[model samples]
Target chain A: MNKLDNQVIIDRLQAVLGDKVHVLGEPHGLLAIQTESAYILELLAFVKNDELLRLNYLTDITAVHYPLQEKQYAVVYHLHNLFQNIRVRVKVFIGGEQPTIPSATSVWQGANWMERETYDFFGIHFEGHPDLRRILNMDDLDVFPMRKEYPLEDPNRIDKKDFYFGR
Target chain B: MSNRITKITPNNPVFYDNDPQDELITLNLGPTHPATHGVFQNVLQIDGERIVSGVSTIGYIHRAFEKIAEHRPFYQITPLTDRLNYCSSPINNMGWHMTVEKLLDIEIPKRVQYMRVIVMELARIADHIICNGILGVDTGAFSGFLYVMQEREFIYEIFEEICGARLTTNIGRIGGFERDFNAIAFDKIREFLKRYPPVLSEFEELFVRNRIFIERTSGVAAVTPEQALDYSWSGPILRATGVDYDVRVTAPYCSYEEFEFDVPVGTNGDVYDRFMVRNEEMRQSMRIIQQALEKIEKEPKGVFHADVPEFYLPPKEQVYNNMEALIYHFKIVMGEWETPKSEVYHAVEGANGELGFYLIHDGGRTPYRLHFRRPSFINYQMFAPMSRGMLISDAIINMSSLNVIAGELDA
Candidate 1:
């Protein structure tokens, strides 16, 4: 294997991913690679099994909500290849109203629950999961609590007017 | 006989069917099953004693730790890590604070960092003992379990000497340990080292060569090194598959780079290999403890904490005498310290696996987002592949070998 520098690796990845890679500066030491929903699984598959860059382990899968952005949710995949012993972060952006990303279960079976959990907390749907249901949340839950726009009610501000209304 | 037969006449129709040659049954192994150390449930589709398929049902112990962390102040989360993976509380505490410190770029003193390494390794041994001993018991080697527990008791005593509690030891703060290592605790660890071997040997005697134990575990949950890596298996699970990857050696956090220890790797990724790896790890942990003891004995007067007192709480003596000290202490206690806005991920090689904390701080006392890459939770993904087609008893042993702490899994 060629011993490539970190920049060379990044440049090579950019060459392969073209305009899909969006290097966000806010999250330090992270390369937020943005891709379309349809290409989610393809990018993951290439990362995991690609000869040049074999990122076999899916370290973590999570979703972050940016309420201000045109794409309100970004599903992130942290991948690591034991052979190369390097980790790469992949992010796919999805619109808030109907957030969805292709499932990477076929590429890495470990993504099964992590994707489900991302869905459970942030309501980001995985297009091809075998069972895409509420994981940590109750079945009756109506809201994705982790969303940036999710309403958070103040516990101390409860109105006593409701208590006296029927009285 | 004819009169008895007549008296026992069939009162109901026989459902108009012939008996099936074979029958398959679905068994729900509880959210309270004795086999599951904590509250865990497994819905098993079985054909006689052989399990066809099984689905693990977790979340019975979920405390919504992530949600709770959002509301609590920074220091308060130290005690919460104690609850996440209760078996290895020190590691959890260390991992959490390390992530926060990484975000803040706090530089702890070498002595304090070394102390963290020693205590964390000790906690890892205690955790592995619980896991390996429980696996032994599940395989019907009860004596091995008893012996391991006895050794664990000694480790627990040292923990009690340091902290008021044993099980949930909220030992470390953000910058360093809550208190300096006492002489008594150090003495207790030395005594434990002497007595620990015979106990581990006794367990090895009872199970290592026992044909039944070996047969039950050896190939029951055989996963290749590649498969283990693919599933993000860590600690014993990853090592059992012949991967010499210990995060202490690989990443070296908390000054683990200073320690001289071997990363034990096994030939096969099976339950037996996991057992062997954990046993060898116990030995390695003893080596680390011995080295730490020698170092501490030589230099007992070294400072126990870092220079960053603003990040860490100041001593009570200084707090009362000095106004600046009082304000810094107050700021730390109130979790109002102006921690720089940043995100960092800290990975520590915990007893079970790679325990990582992905902390995102939005220039606040509390973290904006905190995610735990819990080993138990990820390792449990391999259980289905490991247990399918194995006997029900083998499945139980395999599950035990995986060491899926329900608290960590559900958290």
Candidate 2:
């Protein structure tokens, strides 16, 4: 009935999440909150089931590979409450040789393909993903092509040298 | 046994049904089947034509657009978006442009916004025509597909006149259109506007009341509003489930709020309702286009793009003559322009659904990361789950009605 402003939503989130969800400040007006990988599910569950702002729709689940950061991976979730017309972005930073985070498939069934696509591209494993394999690449793809190390152009191509193009 | 497809596998090495009397037959619908519109393989476990389960294998045509976008500059990414939902690429192009514009905080002219609305609504109509017509083809009705496809040519001609290409039309630039609508383009649009209605109504007449069509589609693959929401379904599919959530009305980008049109919804959430909802939305799209044409005439003419010289490519003649224009052109082409560190997610009510671009620009010439929340990719997840109890024919028609464009699906 009342419009759920960012303050009310953030207040509720802070109450339950405490310091886990650090307010990353509104980057482009969407409430982007950062949390550790351990608390992502708790943070996601609270916002989704909260009585006033039931952000029930899982818009998209994607991961960003940040090779330079202390945490090398950031798994992002965009959740929307269609009834209230509000959205909150939940991001969890995880890093290791095998970066894994608790899957959101428990919260949203639609997260299955999204998480699979994320894993396929970023190689960030979802701890409990029902089907965790490549969705958009060959089954035998050895490397995640989206990672920073993987160059777009073929390194072996002699014709594509920057010197040849007069750059 | 080692290669058992408990998860979706590319090839079937072995499949065994323990009970011989009621043994399930494994049927691969396609990585290349006519029923599966775009390239996708659905391995359906069926028993006497009743589907037990289906595992869909996508990614045959995955060009890795997201990977490609990360390496390219903002201006060059339009062609990649053009390929996403090639059926209505102008929307994808505009949506990508709008995302970049949001990052740069560029304000477009009211005239440009109205022009965009016309092109976008036209795309919506073209897309719905292809989809609903294909649904007819999927059903036994062959004549309706032929009749409706004729109208698509006029729309394609309108696009060709505007942007010199059709299908994968990179129709607009950042800030606004590359060029103002020429006289012939407007005339062709006017001609299309006048000609399309009767054909659309006739197409509907053949399918809407046909006892066979109704009986076939009415109760097939029905989903409730709650179920649809759970699957994050958007566009006509979710609308057919009786949810009035449309990104155009809800978020109102590109001055969409200024337009007067209704978001048509359906209650059944079945194959028939999805079909009817798209048909009604096409009518609404026509309404929006008519209003846009009237509204664009009232604005000051010839302002095709926004006034941001920093990003907007200047005319070739100016680049040759002027110093500022030449420097700016060089900076743009070389991807040397400055960008602030920020992340933005912008969604346009694409023909398929809420096609969103999640862009993360970390003070780089190119986006640090860009993720396309493609509607087909998200909505297609529900197909396998929904097809479990239905007959194989119903599953094929259900996939058709959902309008899963593989370009977007495996993007």
* Clashing residue pairs, backbone N/CA/C < 3 A, model 1: none
Residue-wise C-alpha lDDT for candidate 2, range B133-185, written one tens digit per residue: 98998888989999989998889989999999989998899989999999998
Docking class of 2: medium
- Per-residue lDDT of candidate 1, residues A1-167 (tens digit): 87633465567667887765655543545444567777777778776667777767788888777787898887777876566556667777789577877888888778888887888889988888988887666768899877755545545775755876785
Q: Per-residue lDDT for A1-167 in model 2, tens only?
A: 88887888888887877888788778777988899988888877887888877998999999898888999989999989888778788888899999999998888888899999999988999999989999989999899998989999887989977899899
TM-score, B chain, candidate 1?
A: 0.93
Which portions of model 2 miss their true places by more than 4 Å? A158-167, B1-19
Model 1 per-residue lDDT at B74: 78
True contacts preserved, each candidate? 0.39, 0.90
Candidates' TM-scores? 0.92, 0.95
